[model samples]
Target: MREFMVELTTAVPEGTDPAEVDRRRAAEAVRAGELAEQGRLFRLWRPVGEVRSVGIWRADDESDLRSNVLGSLPLWPWMTAAVTPLQPHPNDPGPTG
Candidate 1:
């Protein structure tokens, strides 16, 4: 598996119903949990006062990450993501280190 740093920014379109937004957000949470359980999603964080998130994710490759993992998100239609492939550095301490 390859790891990536993903930054996601969400923008709900104007005139969208609040209830619909709430529903999708709920679904998105559930999907995120599933990914985490599958060991594909490592960590997620939201910046202060921003409707954006940064996370660490894993997949077979960028194609798999985009077509399967990210495309499955409920809020994908409203989200814009930037993905950066991660590489281990010799001096860096890993997860267990």
Candidate 2:
């Protein structure tokens, strides 16, 4: 049970909204029952790409993170996105007393 940060760079094709596409991807991932299983996905951030759409997946492991992303890539949206591995952060969101 390791924590990781999964970075996603989304490139929506012409006549597409990166935000919308990303939302759709999220929904599909949820429907497929992969997002949560992959990890907690504590937080998500964006506004870091050409189209201003990036995501930070708070995943548990590499495989789970990859599977979550793959579950809804080009299928959910007619666009291309890269789910890259980012260095894990030192801080862990552990239970606080």
Candidate 3:
């Protein structure tokens, strides 16, 4: 199988706040079902950036990725998110341990 990099940017769905309750709820959902089966969550930090969270994902393909997001994340139906397919590069630095 091939490897890919997925960048998922999530918005705190309207009344949701990324700092307090929302993050906790999300973390719960991650623990309850998602993280074990589908995602590795390579990066999650709040030091400083354009986005609040950043994760590096590994999957079999696009469909697998979708199955993961829709199945795991407790995001609202109207929540906004973006997923990008990263190109493979010998020198890409990519996601590291």
Among all candidates shown, the one with the greatest lDDT: 1
Q: Candidate 3 on 9-81: residue-level lDDT in tens?
A: 4555566555765665666566535553544443344437665344555566767656764345655243443
Rank order (by lDDT, best first): 1, 2, 3
Pull out the clashing pairs in model 2.
Answer: none
**Candidate 1 vs 2: which has more lDDT:** 1
TM-score-wise, the better of 1 and 3 is 1
* TM-score of candidate 2 on Cα atoms, chains taken together: 0.41
Query: How many clashes in candidate 3?
Result: 0
In model 3, the Cα lDDT at residue 95 comes to: 58
The worst-scoring run of ten residues by lDDT in candidate 2 lies at 70-79
Residue-level lDDT tens digits of model 1 in 1-97: 9999999999999999999999999999999999999999999999999889999999999999988999899999998999999999999776773
The candidate, 2 or 3, that scores higher on TM-score is 3
User: Any idea how many clashes model 2 has?
Assistant: 0
Model 1 ranges with Cα > 4 A deviation = none
Candidate order, TM-score descending: 1, 3, 2
| TM per prediction | 0.94, 0.41, 0.51
- Tens-digit lDDT track of model 2 for 1-97: 4445544444456887778777776775665355556555545556634443445565456676566544354443444446566664589565675
lDDT of 1 at 43: 94
Give all candidate RMSDs, comma-separated. Answer: 1.3, 5.7, 4.7
